[model samples]
Target: MSEGPLDDLDRRIVHSLQQNARKTSASEIAEQAGVSASTVRNRIQNLEAAGILTGYRPEVNYEAASYQLQTLIVCTAPVPEREVLAKKALEVPGVVAVREIMTGTENVHVEAIGSDGDDLSRIGRDLDEIGLEVVDEDLIRNEYECAFHGFDVKDV
Candidate 1:
Protein backbone atom coordinates (compact mmCIF):
# COMPACT_ATOMS: atom_id res chain seq x y z
CA MET A 1 0.00 0.00 0.00
CA SER A 2 2.99 2.29 0.55
CA GLU A 3 6.43 2.79 -0.97
CA GLY A 4 8.33 2.68 2.31
CA PRO A 5 10.61 5.60 3.16
CA LEU A 6 11.28 6.73 -0.45
CA ASP A 7 12.06 10.44 -0.46
CA ASP A 8 11.19 12.79 -3.35
CA LEU A 9 14.59 12.41 -4.99
CA ASP A 10 14.43 8.62 -4.72
CA ARG A 11 11.05 8.57 -6.40
CA ARG A 12 12.20 10.83 -9.24
CA ILE A 13 15.32 8.76 -9.87
CA VAL A 14 13.18 5.61 -9.95
CA HIS A 15 10.68 7.24 -12.28
CA SER A 16 13.44 8.30 -14.67
CA LEU A 17 14.89 4.80 -14.66
CA GLN A 18 11.48 3.30 -15.26
CA GLN A 19 10.99 5.50 -18.31
CA ASN A 20 14.19 4.41 -19.99
CA ALA A 21 16.80 2.50 -18.07
CA ARG A 22 19.26 1.73 -20.88
CA LYS A 23 19.28 4.89 -22.98
CA THR A 24 18.98 7.39 -20.12
CA SER A 25 22.35 8.42 -18.77
CA ALA A 26 23.16 9.31 -15.15
CA SER A 27 23.42 13.03 -15.99
CA GLU A 28 19.99 12.91 -17.65
CA ILE A 29 18.49 11.21 -14.60
CA ALA A 30 20.22 13.73 -12.35
CA GLU A 31 18.77 16.62 -14.35
CA GLN A 32 15.27 15.14 -14.26
CA ALA A 33 15.45 14.01 -10.65
CA GLY A 34 17.10 17.30 -9.57
CA VAL A 35 20.28 15.71 -8.33
CA SER A 36 23.92 15.55 -9.39
CA ALA A 37 25.32 12.69 -11.50
CA SER A 38 27.28 11.39 -8.51
CA THR A 39 24.11 11.50 -6.46
CA VAL A 40 22.24 9.59 -9.12
CA ARG A 41 24.93 6.91 -9.21
CA ASN A 42 24.98 6.60 -5.43
CA ARG A 43 21.21 6.43 -5.15
CA ILE A 44 21.00 3.82 -7.91
CA GLN A 45 23.52 1.63 -6.10
CA ASN A 46 21.54 2.01 -2.90
CA LEU A 47 18.29 1.22 -4.70
CA GLU A 48 19.79 -1.93 -6.19
CA ALA A 49 21.13 -3.00 -2.82
CA ALA A 50 17.73 -2.34 -1.26
CA GLY A 51 16.06 -4.53 -3.91
CA ILE A 52 13.75 -1.78 -5.15
CA LEU A 53 15.62 -1.93 -8.47
CA THR A 54 16.31 -5.51 -9.36
CA GLY A 55 17.08 -5.78 -13.10
CA TYR A 56 16.19 -4.36 -16.49
CA ARG A 57 15.25 -6.12 -19.69
CA PRO A 58 13.67 -5.09 -22.96
CA GLU A 59 10.00 -5.81 -23.67
CA VAL A 60 9.46 -8.24 -26.54
CA ASN A 61 6.49 -8.03 -28.90
CA TYR A 62 5.39 -11.58 -29.58
CA GLU A 63 3.14 -10.78 -32.54
CA ALA A 64 5.74 -8.69 -34.30
CA ALA A 65 8.03 -11.64 -34.01
CA SER A 66 7.27 -15.15 -35.29
CA TYR A 67 5.18 -15.99 -32.24
CA GLN A 68 1.84 -14.77 -33.61
CA LEU A 69 -0.54 -15.98 -30.91
CA GLN A 70 -0.33 -14.66 -27.37
CA THR A 71 -2.53 -15.95 -24.57
CA LEU A 72 -3.28 -15.71 -20.89
CA ILE A 73 -4.23 -18.99 -19.25
CA VAL A 74 -5.90 -18.85 -15.87
CA CYS A 75 -5.31 -21.96 -13.81
CA THR A 76 -6.45 -23.01 -10.35
CA ALA A 77 -4.32 -24.99 -7.96
CA PRO A 78 -3.38 -24.99 -4.28
CA VAL A 79 -0.57 -22.57 -3.35
CA PRO A 80 1.86 -25.42 -2.83
CA GLU A 81 1.00 -27.00 -6.14
CA ARG A 82 0.87 -23.63 -7.89
CA GLU A 83 4.61 -23.02 -7.70
CA VAL A 84 5.55 -26.40 -9.14
CA LEU A 85 2.96 -26.00 -11.85
CA ALA A 86 4.32 -22.56 -12.67
CA LYS A 87 7.85 -23.89 -13.06
CA LYS A 88 6.62 -26.78 -15.16
CA ALA A 89 4.62 -24.43 -17.33
CA LEU A 90 7.89 -22.88 -18.48
CA GLU A 91 8.86 -26.20 -20.04
CA VAL A 92 5.74 -26.18 -22.19
CA PRO A 93 6.40 -24.92 -25.71
CA GLY A 94 5.54 -21.26 -26.29
CA VAL A 95 4.94 -20.49 -22.61
CA VAL A 96 6.87 -17.41 -21.58
CA ALA A 97 6.03 -16.53 -18.00
CA VAL A 98 3.87 -18.01 -15.29
CA ARG A 99 2.75 -15.77 -12.45
CA GLU A 100 1.19 -16.92 -9.20
CA ILE A 101 -1.65 -14.54 -8.40
CA MET A 102 -2.63 -14.41 -4.73
CA THR A 103 -6.26 -13.55 -5.45
CA GLY A 104 -8.28 -14.65 -8.48
CA THR A 105 -10.56 -17.40 -9.83
CA GLU A 106 -7.24 -19.00 -10.63
CA ASN A 107 -4.02 -18.67 -8.69
CA VAL A 108 -1.71 -19.15 -11.72
CA HIS A 109 -1.65 -16.90 -14.77
CA VAL A 110 0.42 -18.25 -17.62
CA GLU A 111 1.57 -15.88 -20.34
CA ALA A 112 2.20 -17.87 -23.47
CA ILE A 113 3.04 -17.45 -27.16
CA GLY A 114 2.14 -19.75 -30.03
CA SER A 115 2.55 -19.89 -33.78
CA ASP A 116 -0.97 -21.14 -34.52
CA GLY A 117 -4.02 -23.03 -33.29
CA ASP A 118 -2.16 -26.33 -32.98
CA ASP A 119 0.48 -24.72 -30.79
CA LEU A 120 -2.21 -23.29 -28.50
CA SER A 121 -3.94 -26.63 -28.24
CA ARG A 122 -0.63 -28.30 -27.38
CA ILE A 123 -0.21 -25.88 -24.49
CA GLY A 124 -3.59 -26.82 -23.05
CA ARG A 125 -2.81 -30.50 -23.41
CA ASP A 126 0.60 -29.95 -21.81
CA LEU A 127 -1.04 -28.35 -18.80
CA ASP A 128 -3.58 -31.13 -18.56
CA GLU A 129 -0.81 -33.71 -18.64
CA ILE A 130 0.83 -31.94 -15.71
CA GLY A 131 -2.48 -32.02 -13.79
CA LEU A 132 -2.89 -28.25 -14.02
CA GLU A 133 -6.38 -27.39 -15.17
CA VAL A 134 -6.93 -24.20 -17.08
CA VAL A 135 -10.10 -22.55 -15.80
CA ASP A 136 -10.09 -19.99 -18.62
CA GLU A 137 -8.10 -18.81 -21.60
CA ASP A 138 -8.02 -15.48 -23.37
CA LEU A 139 -6.21 -14.54 -26.57
CA ILE A 140 -4.49 -11.19 -26.40
CA ARG A 141 -5.72 -8.93 -29.21
CA ASN A 142 -3.45 -5.94 -28.82
CA GLU A 143 -1.30 -4.39 -26.15
CA TYR A 144 -1.01 -0.70 -25.27
CA GLU A 145 2.03 -1.25 -23.12
CA CYS A 146 4.06 0.96 -20.79
CA ALA A 147 6.43 0.41 -17.94
CA PHE A 148 4.98 1.52 -14.56
CA HIS A 149 7.94 0.12 -12.63
CA GLY A 150 5.39 -1.45 -10.28
CA PHE A 151 4.57 1.85 -8.53
CA ASP A 152 2.71 5.13 -8.82
CA VAL A 153 5.08 8.11 -8.47
CA LYS A 154 2.64 10.94 -9.19
CA ASP A 155 2.64 12.30 -5.59
CA VAL A 156 6.09 11.08 -4.64
Candidate 2:
Protein backbone atom coordinates (compact mmCIF):
# COMPACT_ATOMS: atom_id res chain seq x y z
CA MET A 1 0.00 0.00 0.00
CA SER A 2 1.12 3.58 -0.61
CA GLU A 3 2.25 5.73 2.31
CA GLY A 4 -0.68 8.05 1.88
CA PRO A 5 -3.54 9.17 4.11
CA LEU A 6 -4.99 6.37 6.18
CA ASP A 7 -8.13 4.84 4.73
CA ASP A 8 -11.03 3.64 6.85
CA LEU A 9 -9.54 0.25 7.63
CA ASP A 10 -6.13 1.71 8.38
CA ARG A 11 -7.64 4.32 10.67
CA ARG A 12 -9.65 1.64 12.45
CA ILE A 13 -6.51 -0.37 13.02
CA VAL A 14 -4.68 2.61 14.42
CA HIS A 15 -7.61 3.54 16.61
CA SER A 16 -7.89 0.03 18.00
CA LEU A 17 -4.18 -0.09 18.79
CA GLN A 18 -4.43 3.29 20.42
CA GLN A 19 -7.16 1.98 22.69
CA ASN A 20 -5.01 -0.83 24.09
CA ALA A 21 -1.94 -1.68 22.10
CA ARG A 22 -0.28 -3.78 24.82
CA LYS A 23 -3.15 -6.01 25.85
CA THR A 24 -5.03 -5.99 22.55
CA SER A 25 -3.95 -8.33 19.80
CA ALA A 26 -4.14 -7.67 16.08
CA SER A 27 -6.79 -10.37 15.77
CA GLU A 28 -8.79 -8.87 18.60
CA ILE A 29 -8.71 -5.39 17.12
CA ALA A 30 -9.69 -6.84 13.81
CA GLU A 31 -12.76 -8.42 15.35
CA GLN A 32 -13.77 -5.23 17.12
CA ALA A 33 -12.92 -2.88 14.27
CA GLY A 34 -14.58 -5.17 11.74
CA VAL A 35 -11.54 -6.14 9.68
CA SER A 36 -9.52 -9.31 9.12
CA ALA A 37 -6.71 -10.07 11.56
CA SER A 38 -4.12 -10.20 8.80
CA THR A 39 -5.32 -6.88 7.49
CA VAL A 40 -5.02 -5.36 10.94
CA ARG A 41 -1.50 -6.68 11.40
CA ASN A 42 -0.33 -5.56 7.99
CA ARG A 43 -1.87 -2.11 8.34
CA ILE A 44 -0.32 -1.62 11.78
CA GLN A 45 3.11 -2.56 10.42
CA ASN A 46 2.67 -0.13 7.58
CA LEU A 47 1.63 2.67 9.92
CA GLU A 48 4.62 2.02 12.14
CA ALA A 49 6.96 2.00 9.17
CA ALA A 50 5.41 5.29 8.00
CA GLY A 51 6.08 6.80 11.44
CA ILE A 52 2.38 7.34 12.06
CA LEU A 53 2.30 4.55 14.60
CA THR A 54 5.27 5.22 16.84
CA GLY A 55 6.62 2.99 19.56
CA TYR A 56 4.48 1.94 22.47
CA ARG A 57 5.16 3.13 26.01
CA PRO A 58 3.71 2.33 29.39
CA GLU A 59 2.01 5.16 31.21
CA VAL A 60 3.74 5.17 34.56
CA ASN A 61 2.54 6.89 37.71
CA TYR A 62 5.22 9.54 38.25
CA GLU A 63 4.00 10.26 41.81
CA ALA A 64 4.80 6.72 42.91
CA ALA A 65 8.29 7.15 41.53
CA SER A 66 8.93 10.12 43.89
CA TYR A 67 7.94 12.68 41.30
CA GLN A 68 5.29 14.24 43.53
CA LEU A 69 4.98 17.58 41.85
CA GLN A 70 3.41 17.95 38.42
CA THR A 71 2.74 21.15 36.58
CA LEU A 72 1.43 22.56 33.31
CA ILE A 73 3.19 25.61 31.96
CA VAL A 74 1.64 27.56 29.11
CA CYS A 75 3.50 30.29 27.33
CA THR A 76 2.79 32.91 24.68
CA ALA A 77 5.50 33.59 22.12
CA PRO A 78 6.29 33.81 18.44
CA VAL A 79 5.28 30.68 16.53
CA PRO A 80 8.76 30.39 15.01
CA GLU A 81 10.40 30.42 18.44
CA ARG A 82 8.00 27.96 20.09
CA GLU A 83 9.87 24.89 18.93
CA VAL A 84 13.21 26.18 20.19
CA LEU A 85 11.69 27.26 23.47
CA ALA A 86 10.08 23.85 23.83
CA LYS A 87 13.45 22.18 23.26
CA LYS A 88 15.02 24.39 25.89
CA ALA A 89 12.20 23.49 28.28
CA LEU A 90 13.28 19.86 27.97
CA GLU A 91 16.69 20.85 29.42
CA VAL A 92 14.85 22.14 32.47
CA PRO A 93 15.36 19.87 35.47
CA GLY A 94 12.03 18.03 35.47
CA VAL A 95 10.31 18.68 32.18
CA VAL A 96 8.93 15.57 30.54
CA ALA A 97 7.12 16.75 27.43
CA VAL A 98 6.90 20.01 25.58
CA ARG A 99 3.84 20.41 23.34
CA GLU A 100 3.19 23.12 20.85
CA ILE A 101 -0.47 24.09 21.19
CA MET A 102 -2.81 26.45 19.44
CA THR A 103 -4.75 28.70 21.73
CA GLY A 104 -5.90 32.26 21.77
CA THR A 105 -3.22 33.17 24.30
CA GLU A 106 -0.48 30.57 24.14
CA ASN A 107 1.54 28.68 21.61
CA VAL A 108 3.64 26.37 23.76
CA HIS A 109 2.70 24.03 26.61
CA VAL A 110 5.04 22.12 28.88
CA GLU A 111 4.59 19.27 31.30
CA ALA A 112 7.06 19.15 34.16
CA ILE A 113 7.55 16.55 36.81
CA GLY A 114 9.31 17.39 40.06
CA SER A 115 10.44 15.55 43.16
CA ASP A 116 8.83 18.00 45.55
CA GLY A 117 7.71 21.56 46.06
CA ASP A 118 11.27 22.88 46.03
CA ASP A 119 11.99 20.95 42.85
CA LEU A 120 8.86 22.36 41.25
CA SER A 121 9.92 25.88 42.17
CA ARG A 122 13.28 25.38 40.51
CA ILE A 123 11.64 23.96 37.43
CA GLY A 124 9.40 26.98 37.20
CA ARG A 125 12.40 29.26 37.37
CA ASP A 126 14.33 27.28 34.80
CA LEU A 127 11.34 27.41 32.47
CA ASP A 128 10.98 31.14 33.07
CA GLU A 129 14.53 31.71 31.87
CA ILE A 130 13.41 30.52 28.44
CA GLY A 131 12.04 34.07 27.95
CA LEU A 132 8.40 33.44 26.93
CA GLU A 133 5.72 35.08 29.00
CA VAL A 134 4.31 32.51 31.37
CA VAL A 135 0.64 32.99 30.67
CA ASP A 136 -0.36 30.41 33.20
CA GLU A 137 1.20 27.90 35.57
CA ASP A 138 -1.19 25.21 36.74
CA LEU A 139 -0.12 22.87 39.52
CA ILE A 140 -1.34 19.42 38.70
CA ARG A 141 -2.82 17.75 41.75
CA ASN A 142 -3.93 14.47 40.23
CA GLU A 143 -4.14 13.27 36.70
CA TYR A 144 -7.79 12.48 36.11
CA GLU A 145 -7.07 10.87 32.77
CA CYS A 146 -4.37 10.40 30.18
CA ALA A 147 -4.49 9.28 26.57
CA PHE A 148 -2.22 8.99 23.57
CA HIS A 149 -3.65 9.41 20.08
CA GLY A 150 -7.41 9.34 20.50
CA PHE A 151 -9.32 9.55 17.23
CA ASP A 152 -12.82 8.56 16.22
CA VAL A 153 -13.04 5.57 13.91
CA LYS A 154 -16.06 7.20 12.33
CA ASP A 155 -13.89 10.13 11.33
CA VAL A 156 -11.71 7.82 9.30
Candidate 2 lDDT by residue in tens digits, 28-104:
87887787889888888898899998898887788889887788988776777777887888888788888887656
How would you encode candidate 1's per-residue C-alpha lDDT over 9-42 as one tens digit per residue? 7777777777778888889878766679999999
Report every candidate's CA lDDT. Answer: 0.83, 0.77
Give the root-mean-square deviation of each candidate in angstroms: 2.8, 3.8
Winning model by lDDT: 1
In model 1, how large is the Cα lDDT of residue 133?
Answer: 87
TM-score of 1: 0.84
Worst 10 residues of 1 by lDDT: 145-154
